[model samples]
Target: MQELEEILRAHAARYPAMEAADYVKLIYQNEFGGCPAAARDGEKERAVPPAGGPLCEPIGGGLCRVHLAALPQGAGPALDRLALATAREAAGSRERFLQKLELLRGLCAAGQLPLDSAALEAFLAQGGAAGPCPPHSGAYQAAYAPGYRVLRQSYADMLPAFLEAERVAARGGVLALDGRCASGKSTLAELIGRVYGCPVFHLDDYFLPPELRTPERFAQPGGNVHYERFEQEILRPFTGGGEVVFRAFDCHAMAMRPPVTVPTAPFAVAEGCYALHPSLRGYYAGAVFLTHTPEKQRQRLMARSPKMLERFEKEWIPLEERYFSACGVEQFCGVTVDTTDLF
Candidate 1:
């Protein structure tokens, strides 16, 4: 570990803009072989498939076939930052950063790192980021309805198709419920959980710890919650059928308590911002996208979280438009449930 840290610090001092791929190559050359090809052959020969199923064959040498099960949502800015930090550390001149990298590698090897939002943010902060991928979007937006009647009605009609798809879990399945904040994704996730008798996981639970939370993020022109951690922890586990422990964010305590082991029942529901990450498309059995006009979404946001309104308006709203709009509910989702129409 000490030797590895020295290598990282030396590399970072020499090449601050070193790509993650290049860093890995350096690590491999220094630790194992001079080339990744030799390392791949050695690892592959000893590679064991994950318990759930066979490993996926990666198209390129960079990504692990096992990682194919993991998906990344449209949280590019956060992810980019994470990658930058990791690259810096991998080639960094700091011993602490190298030590942190060693720890991360250990956690990953042990499969003990919870792939939740907090964990993802920590990973980014520590200097590890997933690949650079484009975000996915859905087509068709529904105008807001005046009352609850339409929303409820729309939900009733849409529930069956969504439920059936989840129950079936056929090839290349996904259920995307896209909506602006306060469009009731949590409520809907609960409803789906109750109806399907499956556990519901909130994406919010994956957010960075309170101490790590930044108001400045909201002030940034296109920043959203750092989602790299969330993708790594919660989303990946949920999609891959790996053992998932439910850990809720304690708003009052502003800390994450230990997770409770969530049962992997026949069907489960995951709800949060960017639940329909492009990489997760084929894995989900069903998708539900909630809709509302920007006005209605804003109203709901103000009603639910007044303090966050400025951030939402100044930061989140535009970020959503720029990053998440392309991956709208309709494009990635098979069933688009218009909240207004149902109520």
Candidate 2:
């Protein structure tokens, strides 16, 4: 628990642009928001949010490891500062707030925060009306300047998928991430690849060539994807644990592109729609279905490709829904993640 606290503090210190008042509020939220399960009397139902920062890889059994050196840059320190500040709400109850007070006391003593011990305690005791910042705040952000935000906002939301990836990796099998078109399958896959160093294969890379897009094929559920080729080129070779070389279908060219090689890893990620088609589902050790509210999905689709929105609304979405219903994609998967808020 204390380790998690220290990690949060270190992360908070990285962003130099954050105001001192915001920093205190951010730290307050961090401490109270993710109080350890042990502190909650061993409750097993609720999940423990990622504590070692956003880009951590799940090791196994709900534990994660953050590799600091692998963290990326360019997202900007302002976002991390703001995210940390607003990531969680104030303590819901007095009891929890008291625990936060204790945690804050420890942090101030350990980190040498400029806050006064007595006045801070008195202010918090009077229902924490300290106006979002601590008094006598110090300029500590420069200690770890020019911080980066590596998917911190969505880290908690991505925990289940991370844990599932760990389980799949342990067994040395493929992990499938299937989802709605705009539901962030590709984003999740990229993040997973970053954290786990796994080979990520996209179903989009196997889109059916023009010749295979016959009316008869379109009539069948999950027929839009070139599963047969995917099986022969990628899944089959991947099963034997070796390099996977496959031709990616070029949608714009309406032809097969040159072959690309993906090196084998402890676990491989198969992502995008139709990834969990019945013919391909059996290969995965674990699968996660990503979904979002219709409104959010449309919003994302518009932002990504405004010209294709009508086609998605009228054609692609219905087809995907049909495949999902006919094949029970959500039910068959071990995890179903609602990524509506994460986006």
Enumerate clash totals for all models, in the order shown: 43, 1
- Clashing residue pairs for model 2: 21-133
Give all candidates' CA lDDT scores.
0.46, 0.65
User: What TM-score would every model get versus the actual structure?
Assistant: 0.45, 0.61
Work out how many backbone clashes candidate 1 has. Answer: 43
User: What does candidate 1's lDDT look like per residue over 107-182, in tens digits?
Assistant: 4455443223344345456544332211111110011110000012222334434444444433422244555566
Question: What lDDT score is found at residue 87 in candidate 2?
Answer: 27
Q: Which stretches of candidate 1 lie over 4 Å from their true place?
A: 1-174, 209-228, 238-240, 249-254, 326-329, 341-343
